[model samples]
Target chain A: MEQKETCFAKRVRCIVKLGGAAITSKHKLETIDEENLKEVSSHLRQAFVPDSTSANVLGMDWSRRPGQSEAPSFVDDFSDQPAGDSESFIVVHGAGSFGHFQASMSGVHKGGLSRPLVKAGFVATRISVTSLNLEIVRALAREGIPSIGMSPFSCGWSTCQRNMTKADISMVIKAIDYGFIPVLHGDAVLDTLQECTILSGDVIIRHLAAELKPEFVVFLTDVLGVYDRPPAEPGAVLIQEIAVREDGSWSVVKPKLEDTSKPVEFTVAAHDTTGGMVTKITEAAMIAKLGIDVYITKAATEHSVKALSGILKGGIPDDWLGTAIRYMS
Target chain B: MEQKETCFAKRVRCIVKLGGAAITSKHKLETIDEENLKEVSSHLRQAFVPDSTSANVLGMDWSRRPGQSEAPSFVDDFSDQPAGDSESFIVVHGAGSFGHFQASMSGVHKGGLSRPLVKAGFVATRISVTSLNLEIVRALAREGIPSIGMSPFSCGWSTCQRNMTKADISMVIKAIDYGFIPVLHGDAVLDTLQECTILSGDVIIRHLAAELKPEFVVFLTDVLGVYDRPPAEPGAVLIQEIAVREDGSWSVVKPKLEDTSKPVEFTVAAHDTTGGMVTKITEAAMIAKLGIDVYITKAATEHSVKALSGILKGGIPDDWLGTAIRYMS
Candidate 1:
């Protein structure tokens, strides 16, 4: 319905991070379930843009609800971001369960303490993560894409004492010269000593993997790869092929999943805390030490974006215990 | 010297995200090193927000870095949202090595494809991770953190439509009700669908651990915790109580740090990115699967945030590596 990208270097960019438990599958207390956030916003617009079925999924606000005591009418929090170019494809997401599931049941991670009462816990996890980022920016404006969300904690946790990194690259190089698909996630930023630290969508996926070094970093996660033992015990094993050896010598090749081996462990709704399996093999060993070749899978599985485009055509998978990391230099 | 806040609460807001690889690490130059961001605007100030050795670092720029033939500066990326609340502490970052390290080194991850710019070997490691997140947002504003920068693909990515989960919590609740401290990083956030993931800082610490649920989920890194092998190897052990028990089991039990650890894996100037140690243990194991209680530590040891406030007042640093599960309802 909105799609506008007529020109702008053809515009097709992306940077994504979404896993608030894949939109409330684990905590739906007050509201937020619009058919499971439009089935994960229709798989985040056909898995990170281009055509996205036909587009049309912007600013979705089904009227809020996380235990509603009152105060947060941030209403459907600001919207308008996500457009396109480079043949038109841009994306950004965050609000798993529409948003910090009531800001992690109201702890406010860093949202000032004492006075924030309206339904506290940092104003209901900042009003359900700003109403699940305006219901995925109205599902990316009903899918044409031309969206926009912005809030890297309002100017990206201040990329330090403002030169605003050249005004945030001249406003994303003027939204890639006026195209779009700017969205972003995680907020509650604003720190000098500490009122918030929750700013990691990989710090905006390593600053867009360092400004569009993209192609792959998929990581959907609920679980589908990397496993050897605590995979819920029993037969255990799923690594697949993380072998990245150049000199860094990394390895972890297990693949062969599906019988519901159940080794991917979560156990059930945050089994008392403490992070699992050494924190996803230490974040897949830091996305294979940032050469970025991570897959992990599970976010509602099945072809998970062509199994992440077969690890960007390198393939791998086959049951994936994988885990290999290298390039440490 | 700013340090006041004895805890009564109210005017003590905070948000600081500075990590574009600690602000252009003295201009290794891939981009935005604007003379090391004008030397982090005279080490930001306000008496350095509460005396960390006599604070005083103060600087603020919402957004605007357009060079490479620039012009589109939304009046220098629109600024206006801090009208007082006095008891403030804000710093956000991004755009250090400016223009996201040359739009992540020319090739631009995938969406700018060329066979993944030569099959992920990294031709520019995405402009050295967009100039190391603008040199960790100008080295935390050259060490006095009252900062602000923005870029989540410029002004927190935006397209047109809206509803990006309430625009990702209304860009961090309107930069914490405008006291400001809403920076963001890991730029190049397009995502109209998928392909670009490490919006990492662990997805802004998992959307602020689901919107300020933060009982604790630190990570810090540069070194200090989460080790057993890589801190340069030789007896590298630094387990320091991984714990986990209840039956999910995990063991290790403290006493290993051998002096903290800390090795974000790779990145001399980027490509071998950071989020290191496998993205700080898989985004601190998905924010400790949401119950919180994960630390990781090291942002430069020394009193290490007062030994992380004495491991945040008690238990869990090794609740036996906490692996609780619930499987999300």
Candidate 2:
């Protein structure tokens, strides 16, 4: 095991969160957004070469496409670098529509194992989320990425009153050291206080970031980025950047909007048992306070790729259109 | 959590091992023996009602099939019992051809994560086995049985020098208490001494038996029962019964076989990364020594169902034609 650990450094390059709504049809139960999944996988393949020795064999063109000026130029030079230097990142995805229905119907998140309906729901929810996890892993595998689906609940992750109490990530660490990307997802887990509860992807990433301390974190959602109000609102505007202080407080940094007095509010989808956008921002802020920048952007877009690869190449590009949350200097 | 523990009771009723060869097409990569799986699941449903209250709703016919005189008579009265009286059992299935190909090709069982091929094989093997697990779970679920797929490796199971050192079965216990059948399978897990190793379903059942202490165990195989020699060999005779003693020694209990001196010998399949038939008997003998009787019988057969339901009701039927290993009284 020690010898194997030396093959790939233990350092995690970054953590990517593929929001459920971005990769799956949130309104349709268990429906995957195939096109978005494929595009995201293709972009990931472009960003990270699997093996340094096989770099020449792939012969992939990493140049920016026509009319996509916002795409970072760093990606164009990605293929030129040695594959051995390829960055390894972890992927965390939302359950989206796959499990939310069953979870909500059974009230699994509320956690009452004594109820037969709740128990049945817990089983059904796991089946749905794990099925989606497999789909994501398969898509990544098709792109020559060795993605292993690691469900949080099955990996001995549990909570006490909805707070994570146990999270065994040794296998996760071993997987990264062995050159495999561990793809995790929101899952229904046993809770000491509630009997069973939903562990959201946002919470999973926060826990991971605290332990692995990745260089940066990327959250790919259905919308462009965080908005002052729900994206559907008429006056909703994307909050370009936010900075978190040591005291866990955050403020909008970019755009310098006049309405800084009001708190950013987001709505949770009816079927989403786990807290939705609000949870993502809360977790991101926690991560930002740890000195790790977190970027929020839409999946399968040039801006998303730019945020992902630009950070891998050392800094986020100026043209990137995403919400960047960083520690206040 | 403590309040919920009083729901179903923590005591396990039984543990069932579904042989890979019995449930899958061993020659076909990743192909499920759908008919066999469905039949076995149907038999399981007939043997155990999911919920006591829903027993009336199911209105299942638990009688012996026509012309199946060997089928135990006790099953005819199963439906007359209260639904709450239904026994709970755990299912453990093998990878069969699904993961064996990948495991053998990558030599993942030999363990060397430092080698890229080995690591890739580990990932592929996991994907194959877990996929089969999902299929089995779905089959059981379709039968109205709450089956949860619990991949050993992903659930924090590992071996040190090929000996299981970490197997957190808290979730399994919780699932059972919640009235769900926790389905586990052979998996590729991190090994402290070897970097990684294959944990066979046989070993998993043995470990589980030691922990859960179920009343009895049933091993479902493709063949009728254990033989003195390979079942396919000429003049091979099924050993009807075996008695295990405190010293970990076992001997033929019935049929008064002429050749008592010779040890039972079985061959391993080419693609089998884990010890096959040999491991099954070895583990069975150990469990028998613990005072728990174990039955090995052909799957999807009336005799198999007899062994299962008969034992659940009280004792094995005298007409059963499977090999029974029990502690010497």
Candidate by candidate, in order, the iRMS in Å equals: 18.8, 13.0
DockQ for the candidate 2 complex? 0.16
**Taking the tens digit of each residue's C-alpha lDDT, what string does model 1 give over B145-262?**
4233444444444322211221234344444444433345554443333322224334554554555453444443344555555556566455554444333323344553333333
Off by over 4 Å in 2: A1-9, A50-86, A233-235, A258-275, A310-318, B1-9, B50-86, B232-234, B260-275, B310-318
Q: Which candidate's lDDT is highest?
A: 2
Per-candidate interface DockQ score: 0.04, 0.16
**Per-residue accuracy of model 2 over A1-329 as CA lDDT, tens digit each:** 01111233578878999999999987665778999998998777776654423233221111123455221222222232223524689999998877877787668899877665566567667877888898888777656576788888777688898988878677788777767788999998888898899999989899889888888899999888877666666776677888899999888877677666665432223212342566777889999999998999989999988877756335545677778888986
TM-score of model 1, chain A?
0.29
- The candidate that wins on DockQ is 2
The residue-by-residue lDDT of candidate 1 on A1-329, one tens digit each, is 11112233433333444555554454443244456455555655566554436433322222113454222232133232323332333344555544454344333454443222211233234434544564565554444344555555544343322111211333443454444455566654544344443454544554554444444555554555455554566775555555554443454433445544443333221321422435444444555565655554555445455543334446554444333332334
Question: Could you tell me how far off, in angstroms, the CA of residue A301 lies in candidate 2 after the best superposition?
Answer: 1.5
